[model samples]
Structures are given as C-alpha cells and as structure tokens.
Target: MSANPLLAADCQDGCFFVDGRFVPADTTRDVTEPATGQRLGRCAIAGAEAMRSAIAGASAAQAAWAATPPRERAAVLLRAAQALQSHFDEGALAIARETGGIVPKGQHEMREAVVICQIAAGLPLQAQGQVLPSTPGRLSLATRVPHGVVGVISPFNFPLILGIRAVAPALALGNAVVLKPDPRTPVSGGTIMAEAFARAGLPAGLLQVLPGDAEAGEALVTDPRVPMIAFTGSPAVGRRIGELAGRHLKKVSLELGGANNLVVLDDADPDAAASAIAFGAWFHQGQICMASNRVLVHEAIAGAIRERLVGKATHLPVGDGASGQVALGPMIDARQLQRFDQIVKDTVEQGARLEAGGTHEGLCYKPTVLSGVKPGMRAFDEEPFGPLVNLVTFRSDEEAVTLANQSQGGLAAAVIGRDVARALAIGRRLNAGMVHINDQTVNDECTNPFGGPGLGGNGSAVGGPADIDEYTRWQWVTVKDAPPAFPF
Candidate 1:
C-alpha cells in the first residue's frame, strides 16, 4: 500500500506569528477536516491587541528592510521559496485537513508558491525607475519606493497563494507586510507561510500572519499605519474596502470574484473542448474565481460538445479530497454545499436540463453539467462555485460574444476554435482581464499582472512586475547646483 501522505500535527490550539515569534492568542477556533469531520488543529483568532501589536511591529521594521540591498532582499525570498518546497508535504497535509483539498492539489500549490517566490526575488532588478531629460545643469528623475507597510487580506479558497501574492511582493519591494488569511484555513494560509519566511531568515517583524474573522479584516483595512492594501475576495467586500480605502486616500489592489465564461466555436474540436471544460469547471469543486460559469457553444455544435463533456465529467474521479486520489472534494462547509444545492434546484425548477450529475452525497457534490439553461434563472448567472456548470447555445458569432460578455464579470475568459486568428480577434472584443485564444477560461502565471475588470477587480493586477506598482509608489526628484531666476 502507498504510504499515508498525512501526519498528525501539533498546532497547540492557536498562536499568532508576531515579529518572528509565535505568540499565543487569548482564544482559538477548531479547524476540522472537512472530508472526514476529524479535528485537525486550532487557529489563533487575533484580537484587537494582537492586531495592534502586529501593525506596530511591521511599522517598526519597515525602514530598515527598505534600506537593505535589493539583492539581499531577493536572496531571502529565493530561500523562502525553497523552504516551501522542503516543507511541501507538511503544508499539503495541513491544507487537506483544513480545506479538503487533495494532496496533489496541495503539491501544485507548493510548486506554484515556489515559482512566485522566485519571481518576487527578481523584482529588485525589474522594479527600476526612469530618468528624464532636463535643461541647464538640472537633473530630473522618477524613482520607485516602498509604501512603508502593506496590509494583505486573502480568502480561504486559495489561502497560501493569495497570502503570498501580496506578501511576497511587499517584501520584495522592501515593505513590511501584515497578512490576514481567512479564519477557516489558518494553518495552510497563515502559519505555513510565516514559518517558511522565518526559516528563510527574514528579519523580525518583516512579515506577520494573523488569522481572524471579518472584523479583523476591517481593522486591517482601517488601520492608518498601513498605506496600501492588497485584497482578493468577493465584489461586495471589494467595494466596501475600496470605499474605506478611498476615504483614507490609501493605495489598494483588489482581485475580486468573477463569473468566468468560455466561448466554443463550431470549428473547435469537440473532444478537446470537452476535456478542457471538465477540468476547468470541476477543478477545486468550482471554488476558483476563474472557474467556468458558462460554456457558450455555437448551436450547430452544441449537441456534440454536450455529449462529450458529459462523458468526460462522468469518468473523472470523485472521492475523499483529503486522500489525494480524488479530483472532486467536499464543499468547504455545510453552507457552501447548501448554497450549491439551492442553485441547482432552482435552475432545474426553472426548466434547465440536468445533463449528468447534480446529486450530492454528503458534502462531495458529483461533477454537474446542465444544458438549455437560460437567463433569468438564478443559476444561469450565479457563480456555480461548486463542481457545477451550465451550457447555453448561441446561433451566431455575435450572439456568442453577447452571451460571453453579458455575464456580470470580466475576470478570466476563453475562446476555442480551429481558426486561431478569428478566435484572437473575438477575444479582443471581449471585456476581461485575461483572455485565452485556444485554451480554457482558467489560467494564471507567476509573471504578469493577472487581475480582472468590471466587478472582478479594482483595475489592478496582483502578480508579476505589476505587483511593485500595487505595493509601492513613485516619487520624482530634481537637483540643481543653483536655483534658476523666475521670469516676472
């Protein structure tokens, strides 16, 4: 038999990561395995005092960290990345216990985190300023500088990456970071990253993790010490944060939710499209922000695509997500499963065809596919954030574009067909942050600004070189030997 991938861990109830030290909190919450209902560990819930201490620590540490040589800062991030790899199994186990994510998915996250770390390490070289031409013995230039302290608010779906996406860049640009992961997945989201950076020899107080509820998120948003905030979650929360940040005149980057769509042309290969749709729709049980919410196919090919997609989804594995052998996992909690159930029920009641799988066995929802789904139904536009997807038919190219772009999101989108040039042209017309010509709707890279438009983001991307822009500000300076006389 294969070795058990998980080992019992000692979370010791709950502890806060403050200034390189693990400080115990006054209270804690139990983190149970969603798949098996076993007690995994506890996470420290940050109180007002804990939040204050963390902010003060980060504020105190910012000046010196920004002064450290860029190469040295980058070296630390590189080491941190490697450290994540070394501790991959432990992190994966924790992730599985907390989120019901399979071990292989956890492994993928670890590898991606490593790449992000390496990418952030190179920021020192890429985050440069430009000089401007000047007249008569005066020099003018624009330089980038850290924003002192950054506040990162991440979600539970992608605990580690969301936290690191903000934290890594903040550190790379020589700013201190105070990251608040979702209260549910503290072990994978908060503690794991903190341990990695500390083990990599980051200075005290450079990075801190505090797991807390919505109030804690608000505190992070309103704290005056934090000049910039990087957030990833729902559009409702994003708007609220933006309002608060705007009032304070703080710099903010938001990667909010999306009802992502995929456009299938008549010329596309039915088999290839089915495979992509199955992976994109059911991956992570549709919790991903970029998960395909709609698959708009040309009417001529809709029947063929639906049959193949149903076959493909039916054959995919469904089991205990924590076991690492299953493609589908349990919902994060009873709430999510209940929500998915209601959406599917309402859609079916409103006349949408239940194509393949819609039944739920406990929290593990079998991969679902629906057809003849029309607008006005709740599930037609609601982000089917479980392993559920819908297929809608379009008679013309213009109709396809309208259907694809009509969703209330502009996060990630895809167009697939044999005519590459035509697909590319169509993609340009679609309103989204990221668009793929021949691939699925879900795609993310370690390098580049990857956020969405409309309700999906606040007009800023959170990864790659764009992160510097999100975490720092530019300052212009001019120097002259003597002041020039002003003409009266």
Candidate 2:
C-alpha cells in the first residue's frame, strides 16, 4: 500500500497554522477523499475567534515583513518555490486525493502554482513608484506600499493555484496573508502552502493558514484589520463577499465563477475542435472556473462535432483518482454531484438533447453533452463546475458571439478557426478576459492578467503586473531642502 502523501507534509493531520506554528483547534473535522470517502486526515475547523486571531497575528507581522529588503523578500519566495518543487510528487498526490482531481490535473495545478511563486519572486524587485515633476526646490515621488494584511479565501477546485496566485504576490509585495482554504480540501489548499513557506524560512506570523467554514470566511471579510481580500469561488458567495467587503470598505480582488465558452467556427476541423472541446469541458471533471461550460458551434458542423463529443464522453475512464486508472475523477463531493445531475435534468426539460452521459455512480459523474441548449436553460445560464457540455449552434459569427456573451460571465473564451485574422477578430469581439484564438478556454499562465468583466470578476486582475497593483497602495511623498511657503 502506498503511504498517504498528505502525511508526508507533516501539517495535514490537523491543527491551524497560526503565529508560525501548528496550533490545535478547539474543534476538528475529518478530511476525506471525495473519490473513495477514505479518511485522509483531520484538520482544524477554525471558527471566528481563531480566524480573528490569525488576522491579528498577520497584522502584528506586517511591518517587519514589509521592512525586509526587496532582495531578501524575493529570495524567500524563490526558496519557497524551490521547496514546493522538491515535493512536487507528494503535493500532486495530496491534491488528487483531497480534491478528487485526476493525477494529471493535480500535476498541472502543481506546476502552475510553482511557476506563479517563482514569478512572484521578482515582483518586489520590479520598478515601483515614480518620480514626478516638482517645483525647482522640491522633489516629488509616488511609491507603492503594502496593504498591511490581506485575507485570502480559496475554493476546493484548483485550490493550490488559485490560493498561491494571490498569497505569493501579496507576501512578495510585503503584505501579510491570513488564508482561509475551503474546509473540504484544507490539506492541499492551505497546509501544503504553509509547509513550503515554513521550509523556506519565512518569518513567524507572515502567513497564517486557517482552514474553516463560511463563518471563518465571513469573519475574515468583515474584520477591519484585513484591509484587502483575495477570494476565488462561486458567484453567489462572491457576491456576498463583495457586499460585505464593500460595506467594510476593504479593497477586494474577487476572482469569481465563469460560464466560459468555446466557439467552433465553420472553418475549424471537426477532429481538432472535438478534441479541444472534450479537454476544455471535461478536464478535471469540469471543476475549473475556466472550464468551457458552453460550446458554440457553427450550424454546418454541429452534428459532426456532437458525434465526436459523444464518442469521447462515452469512452472516458471514470473512477477514483487514487487508482490511477481513470481519466475523469469524482466530483469534489456529493453536493456538487447532486447539483450536476439536477442541472442536466433541468436542461433536458428545457428541450436540450442529452446525447451522452447525464449519469453518475457515486461521485463520479459521466461527462455529459447537451445539444440544442439555449438561453434561459439552467445549463446555459448557470456556471457548471462539473462535466456537462451545453452545445449551442449558431449560423453566423455575430450570432456565435451573441450566444457566447449571453451568459452573465465574461471570463475566459476561445475561437476555433483556420483563418487566423478572422478568428482574432471574433475573439476580440468576445467580452472574455482571456481569449484563445486556436485553442480552448482552459488556459492560464503565471504572467497573464487573468480576470474577466461582468459576473465573472470585479475587473481587478491578479498575475504579473496586475499583482503589483492589486497588492499595494500608492503613497506620494515630497522632499525639500527648506520648507516651502504655504498658501495658508
């Protein structure tokens, strides 16, 4: 039997990572594998009190962390990245076990996270602030400063990548973070991150991992000490967080849900389009926010595309990820699985044709394809975090764009066509934050500014230069040899 990969990290058995150490919580919760319902470990179920303490700890550590030299801060992030790289295999397995991602999905997320950490390492050293034109005797400048304490709330799907994308940059820019990973997948979502940073010799209290439920999340958002919030989750929760954070007057970066689209033009090859559709709509069981929830195909090729998609869905391996025998893993939990079934049934009732899938054994939902799905159907309107592909056929490019943009979400999108220039033009018309000309919707890079307009995000992006802007505030200063005469 293989050893539990989570245990190898040493922090997954239980307890909250507070003030530089793992402190046992008053209450604990069992961590189970979604695929097999096997107990992986236990984790602290931090309540409001514990979450506040963690925030306080971050507040106490903020100044010192900010005062550290840029090179030193950069070095720490680099070392943390290296530490994460050292445990790549262990981390991937833990992610797969905890979140029900297939082995490949786990590996991809692990890779992206590590790269993002490394990219963040250079953020502190980037040119910050600027000298402004001033009166002859005076000098004026604007400098970037940390936000003191940032609260990060991450979801179960793509936990490592989503959490680290914010946490690494916030810490890199000298801000402290109090992370609240989803309670369901605490080990991979937060504990693994804490271990990597600790191994890199990060100072005490700089990053506090508080694995908790909605209460803790709410507490983190409402707390006055945490001036910034970085959250990635469903739109409903994102709305609540936005409202609470707004009332608190906090600067929040909400990387919310997406009903992403994949457009297959008439000129696109059926085989290639089908392959991209399968990967986009079903990868990680379509748990990704960037997953292609809607497939908009030109009417001429819709039948051929549907046939290929059904063939792909029917043959996809579905089972427990730990077995290493499945292409599609289980849903994150039973609740999500139930939601998937209900969405498919409702779409069918709305006149969408279910050509394949629409079934599940345990948490492993079959990859589903629904043709003739139109606007107002639950599958077309709602963001699906499962393997259900809603195919909408359009006759013209204008119509394709209309169908794609009908969803409130304007996240990642894709345009598949052989005419590069025409495809680019169509991609530009789409409202998505990121567009793939010849590819699918599920693509991201550490350097890409990844956030969309509309219901998908708040327009505040996170990655590359965007991080520098999101994690810092501007401070203007003026210096003079003598005091300047005042108008008063």
Candidate 3:
C-alpha cells in the first residue's frame, strides 16, 4: 500500500495558546504518521508554567463569558459551526494527515465537528431554568450555572469531533475551557478548533489549546483552578483521572473503553445483519468505542453469518486513507498495532479459530474474524480496539442475552431479530447505555443519550439536550412574598 500524501509531509511547528495569545512551548515533539512511520509535524509540548498560564487564562475569561446572555452564547456557537464548515476541506486534510483517518472518515469527522458546534450553540436556550408552581404569591425557580473553568482531555481517535464536542458545550454554557489535545493528532485538531472559536468572536482567553503527552494531561486534571475535567480515552487513563478528580473533589465526565457486542438471532434477515455488523466492526479499523467487537448469533444461523462475515472481511479494501474504496485504515500508532497483534495472538492461543485475513503491513492489520471463541478468551472479556471480531453461538434467547451481558464493559450493544417483542425484551435486558434493535450500534441524529455503564467509564452520555445539562450545574431559588410573618 502506498503512503498517504498528507502523512508524508514535512513537520510544521506550532505553539500553545495562553491568555488569548499563541505562546511557544518550552519543548517540541515530533509527530509521525503511523501508516508509514514518517514524520508529519512537530507540536509544542506544554510544561508546568504553560499549564498554569492556561488555567489562569481560562479563569480570567470565564466570568465575562458566563455573564453573556444565553442567546448570545448560543449565537457564538452557531457562528463557530459556520466557520468550521467554511474551512472543512483544510481541516479534513489536516485530520487525515495527523490522525491517519482515511480521507473520507476524516472528512466525515470534520463535518461532525461543525455539526457539534451548531448543536452546542443551542445550549444557551436549552439551559433555561425550570419554573415550579409556588403556593400563593411565592415563586420557585431552578437555573443552570457554569462551573467556572473546565479542563478537557481528548483522545487521538476522532480527535476533531470528540474534542470539539466537549469544549463547545462547555464554552456555550459560559465556562472558560482549557483543552489538552491528544498529542498524536494535536496539530490538526487543536489548531482548527482554536481558529474556529476565534473566528466566531469568542472572547480572547475563553478557549485555549495546549498540546503534550501524559504529564501535561496529569497537570490539567490535578490543577486546583480547574473545577471540572472531561476526558475520553482508555480505561486505565480514565481510572487515573477519576482517582485524581475524586481526591480534589472536582467534577468529571469520563468517556472510556468498551468491548461492544452485536446479537443476531436466527429469525432476522441474515444479509442485513451481516452487512451492519461488518460496517460496525471494520469502520475506522474498529477503533471506535461503540464498534461491534463481538458477534453473538443463534446456532442455527451462525454458520451463514460467519461465512458472510468472512467473505466481507476478506475483501475489504485496505490501502492509503486517501483511497475512496478503502474501508479499513491503519491503527493510530505502532503501539496500538502492537497491542492489537498481541490480543489476536492471545485469542488464538486460547482456542479461537482464525477465519479470515490476519495479514499485517506496517500499521495496518487485516480485518480478521475468529470463531469458536468462548467466555474464557481475553477477546471475549476485554475491549479489543482493533478490527478483530470474535464469534460466539447461542442456543436460545436467554442464553444470547446472558452471553452479551457477560462482559464487564457496557458501552453499547445491538440485537437483530424479526420479532420486535423479542428484540425489545433483549434490548431491555442488555446492560449497555445505548441499545440498537434490528441495526448496528452506531450513533445517529444526536438526539439520544449515548454513554456507557460499569467500566465503560463515561459519567454522562454525549447526545441530545441532556449533554448541555452535563456541562452545567443547577441551582434552586425561591422568592418569598414577604420577610416571613415569624420574624424570630
């Protein structure tokens, strides 16, 4: 496979934003394109002083931003969305180059980023206070308030959309934001977001972007000035952030890992189920949190589904992300590729039978399917953030639901069955936050609550009007008709 042209470009140096100014970091790190191990760009690494400066900037600008009317705040968000759309092509190219997302997925993510900003722009209106009926002349009310300064730690996968999704809501709610972009893809995601916010006329120092690795993340999470932290990444890091936030009595929203599953019953349309599962499992090389890593089918139809899956997996186009036909791209970096390879090896060693492509070229791992996988294998129990699927068979509806719920993580799950009653029952029983009936577990419309339970780690789902509430706090107020008869 030829290397993506965007990934092969020379390093472009950049800086961190502090107090509405672009300040150079004390150090720099070289970012590489994982697909071919080529240098893409250099990102400034923020240190302790830079971290403090960002927090101060966020704190300084938050009050004035918060004082702005909700409608005005929302208008800013809408403007940011427009700005993002206006620069879509440039943003897409940067995302594709830095994150190794094939051009199409990169473009799609950049568009979603713009949409997220637009959605967040409506938050000021959505954050309206509730009026409760009071006795006689008294009135009771509740209103949402900003959490002062917020810290956002984004992941490498879906960098553009996910990072902006968190930051936009926070800003729309009138809170100042300090964002730590994923080091691997910071050059594209962080710079683009900052520029969009600036173009929308957001106040200087209201939104800041700092780029670096784990230490910078730790600093942001533990800073005393930051009242809340929103993070999206691995379970290990999520747990650490939780611990630190807990100690500081800070608010946190952790969107973490997942080992999602798709259940296809014998009564369902085999063709549709097979196609949906294939797309969910192989999209972005299965790096997504909601991707179907496990496929549970009824014994009667498992054979047909397995065969179809194998054929589809074998033929998926693998090449430079720029190729329009390509469906699977390389893992974000060599480390992810190594971890995926080890998981496949361990699954095979534990008795799972490999049924399709397992070839590796550079950071690209062929879309693979493994059969005969049981609860004993790690692949069955853990989330494998790669394009590998484990197939398991169930004899009955009860057994299928039990098998699907066996994993500790429960981000999302799906059920495919002809009987609506049966599918609804199974969907109800599934422990995941989002359950898809008769379809793959992919997000749509952005109108529903989407997050996870247990070790999946996210505190709140990221869709619908509820997401606006997540970034803000509520306060109840009551106005007494008089100073009270009993003046004691």
- Scored by lDDT, the top model is 2
TM-score of candidate 1 on Cα atoms, chains taken together: 0.95
lDDT per residue as tens, model 3, 142-174: 878888999999888888877887888889888
Q: Considering TM-score, where higher is better, how would the candidates rank from best to worst? A: 2, 1, 3
Residue range 1-488, candidate 1, lDDT tens digits: 11322222454248888989787788889887778887777788987667877999999999999999998999999999988887787777677667777777777777788889999998887836888888869889899999998999888887888889789988999899999888888877888788789878999999988988877877888889999999988888899999999988888898987678788999999989888888778888888888888888888889999999788678777768877678887878888889898999899999999988888777888889899988787777777788877898999888887877776666888999999998888888887888988888778887868888877888788887687788789999999998889998
Question: Weakest 10 consecutive residues, lDDT, candidate 3?
Answer: 1-10
Q: Model 3, which residues run further than 4 Å from truth?
A: 1-12, 133-137, 480-488
- Which parts of model 2 are misplaced by more than 4 Å? 1-12
Q: How accurate is candidate 1 locally (lDDT)?
A: 0.84
Clashes of each: 0, 0, 2
lDDT of 2: 0.89
RMSD of each: 2.5, 1.7, 3.4
Work out the TM-score per prediction: 0.95, 0.97, 0.94
The model with the greatest TM-score is: 2
In the predicted model 1, the residue pairs found to clash are none
TM-score of 2: 0.97
Ranking by lDDT: 2, 1, 3
lDDT of each: 0.84, 0.89, 0.82
Off by over 4 Å in 1: 1-13, 482-488
